[model samples]
Target: MSAPTSNIADFLRWLETERGLSFAGYPELWRWSTEDLPGFWSAVWGYYGLHHVSDHDEVLADATMPGATWFTGARLNFARQCLAHTTDARPALIAVSETGDPVETSWDRLNEEVAGVAASLREMGVGPGDCVAGYLPNIPQAVVALLATAAVGATWTVCSPDFGTPSVLARLRQARPTVLVAADGYRYAGKEHDRRPHIAEIMDGLPTVRHLVSVDRLYASGAAPDQLPRPDVTRHDWTELADRRARPVFADVPFDHPLWILWSSGTTGVPKGIVHGHGGIVVELLKALGLGVDLRADDRYFFHTSTSWMVWNLMVAGLLHGSTLVLYDGSPTHPDVNGVWRIAERTGATTVGVGAAYLMAAEKDGATPAAERDLTAVRSILQTGSAMPDSTWDWARDRLGPDARLQSICGGTDICSVLAGGSPLLPVRTGRLSGPALGVALASWDAEGRPCVGEQGELVVTAPLPSMPLYFVDDPGRERYTRSYFDVYPGVWRHGDWVTVDADLSVAVAGRSDSTLNRMGVRMGSADLYAVVEGLPRIADSLVIGAELPDGRYYMPLFVVPEEGEPFDDALREEIVGAIRQSLSPRHVPDAVVPVEAVPRTLTGKKLEVPVKRILQGARVSDVSAEGAVTHPDMLAWFARFAARLGSGRS
Candidate 1:
């Protein structure tokens, strides 16, 4: 095959011939980037044509964890760079939602909308360091609101409208936003959900919101939130304020100024609000989109994600490098497992992104997008959210076409961008992420802290990157932030994943290491177990936890949600056990196979394994999570009560 031609390759070629800087391969380029961080970053700023209000004198001043600072003496507005690209030259965005049809927003109009909102927000006394929270869907208005907040140097945070009141309040209350931009309701699965009552609860719970701007999405449905208590503090007509000012006044702030606040899963205790800066994110996304994903100036990118997910932020960041964004809102599997592929076909997207769970469901649904749909425009298929099973790679290949690449990208909400994933320079391998993301000093360290290659160990970043959270909101002295990552490995950032760096230098993630399953001296991930179990047609979903008994025997309980109306009979149990033994080792079989009504998941769709493990291991339910933050709070009661019965020796 011909050598891959990408923006990074071209940039590298340019450096060799024009700038007299030569590198033989990506490893050398990576080394130079991590070693001389200043040179690497300055080159990124120049290469991407980022707009800066003032020049940066120092690329990185401090390198300490939770203390690192980048782009010293620089001033810029992230919104300016995001808007600088063009609505006319390249299509800015095409938005499709369950509530409405596809709506295309040109760069010029998008700029106008952002400017309009920014002007109103500034007039409302929002400025640098202020917070603007949104309870919104993945719609155009959410994008506009976010850019407007960034344009005026205000910190932006968001929660999906689908989240319960307590979940939204857990993070937004800590942000203490001056404005809360929300929706009256949203549609999903061919049904409209009215959120006006939830909006009232959120507004009442948060005393800091000075303005309530509600997007009238249910106009045709004719369902609106109740009248505002204080007209001065709230407004239902979103257009009135957006039209009030069509010219945005941009604000230039320090490089380290907070740009957005993202929340943790909140499965344990209160959620943590992670703060990330403008310059760091700008540089990081520019490289990530341009090099890691090979997004060209005109490539149309579509990632199936909610506004609440960090991938939503990446959808907006595509604008930074002049990539067209197709923002999608609604259930990916609403109409069926093929719904997301239909979106790619309709938008003529060059890249299609979805979580591994979506792919698994599509497999179960027997979806065949390649045969049923025309996706000739798609060039890359991106998968994340969970580890992509080796078997699932075949499923991806059969549906996405042979020409298109299927990349299992890995990143987290904490960074808001990929730390390891596909690269144009690397060879694509089935079931393995290509390698460490450029500029990230990643290594797999064993329990004794020795670097391990071709073996599973803790994932760690030995050096600091710009996109790591600046700090956690409300975390004084960085106490929570410190314990979250650094406490495990001292100076190194422990990413909490069981990762194996293979001999080929490719990376394979084996789920979270803290919840790693060990039996008879062999260690396996819970994801490994679920992969086999969920593949069975009888199993809709499953959760596995290795509970340690006082007598030192490890009790492995497999909780499964049976398929609708399907009886949990002896025949089904035998099949499950046979599959596990055939696919995995004999010891991989569960000690107890229990059927449950539902499996607890986060609002973002992650299985609640760690929290469930603690509950099953005799920890108090209250210690695991607060009721409101959990997606299925009542479902946890079954696990807790079961644990009690088991502990009392009455089961």
Candidate 2:
């Protein structure tokens, strides 16, 4: 086996030597990659030494936006690709928890467990096209279950135990998995949550779940699996399923075979079950993580995430590069404000990825994690979920020292990979993404479908990406899929976020375009407002909502959650208004500054700007966001009450 080097460098060398292609820099390489998608993607397949049972001349068969077919004749399994790179000496997984000490799972152990579970699944009649749903946490067992499902050619989907029963059912019922694997409970914030009852409710809701596998995390060895809820349902322990001595065998399914289902945030409605194929994920992850993020075998990749979030799925792909994955199953700031940093320090994590909100809050709290912990091993600090403020970015750079590169990445669960993020060859910039990812024809397009530069516009992809969803579950006619992405631009994938592409191609993403704020004929993104508002010392968090009333009058309100003991008095409000007027513009200033207990966010830590705007515009709470999909559903009621008092008839 050939040794792994810097993947992007290696690919560039391969392009020059094998393909007779040479580029001066990343910009030229990226341009060529997008222009010749087939050549670039085929090179990725070959450079990674991907093994397939059948070969195909067509890298991408159909270039249609919603129904693009890729690598049709090739056959491979995601499990095989994930496990093939690592050696016996390297650890496959490092599982850490709030209460328990860190445990390392070797590649041999992982393969054995995967083989055992795959055999057990085959015995239970699970096969190709069968769905195996997981209501598991971020643990080794969850990894084992997903790999085993892929090994047997069964599709896999998962939800974190943190999600309530309704949220779990809302997503899982769409897939209708034949087998369900769930943990007995999970621990978070120094507390244990018994989810057996919640699991029962989930089982009752998903009648298609014929076999139930229980992972005993909170229970003892003598504990028995729960009784089957119905006569047709059978119960099995996770350990029992993984105890058999068996050899690993992978099913060589077609390249476009369903691998996994990832759910949208469901902030607007029921989450869409996005299905991605095996070859697409395998190829894309190898490129996105290996090239874009420069992940290496010696690197311990740790991304603070839950199973419900897409980052967890992306983190598992670290195994594709023979890198060890560090999985933490607890609150980011549980034992202390620097808990996550401590985890990185102890694990010797080389790459750390976390939501931007965490860094912002830590900056507000005056946290100096570098001073508190030894983070010298860290080489890259990836921030996602939302754009970071300039001040927070500066603070992070200063705190982490000069060695770590701070990268702000923006993507969605729809792709289950990065659209625009950091590349090893690109220079780090403050409060801006590096550039469009290679093989992504990303652009900022105005309403007229004209590309825009140095100005905010709809983020659109003019070409089909391999990692784009094969199809949304239950959307047989592709109506939902088309309407979701290609509806706006007609044949182009219009990601909902607003972005600005500089002449140099560095991208800056504002908040969601749908939630953009327009006042007195002046337009601005919510993220621009947040970058100013959240940077204030007195403000702990904030949300801005703009609603057009029945009389065609715009009502914009800036809701601020004051820092502890900091009141939203006239003085503070005036400061906020003055800051916006100075930093941005007087035309974009809010009509009112209302203090709130907290700002509502999705489970993944995105502010509920659009949903709250709908609530303030007199929309029903149920019509806007699913309760289970939100971090604080109770805030929806408060917003509704405030709307009621404002009255819809007000001018």
Any idea how many clashes model 2 has? Answer: 0
lDDT of 1 at 39: 77
Compare the candidates by lDDT and give the number of the best one: 2
The Cα local distance difference test for each model comes to 0.84, 0.88
**Could you tell me the TM-score of candidate 1?**
0.95
How many clashing pairs per prediction, in order? 1, 0
TM-score of each model, paired residue for residue: 0.95, 0.97
CA RMSD of each candidate after superposition:
2.2, 2.1
Cα lDDT tens digits for candidate 2, 565-631: 9877999999999999999988779988999999888899998998888877778999888768888
Clashing pairs in 1: 87-107
The segments of candidate 2 whose C-alpha lies over 4 angstroms from its true place after superposition are 1-5, 51-54, 221-228, 648-651
Steric clash pairs (candidate 2)? none
Model 1 clash tally? 1
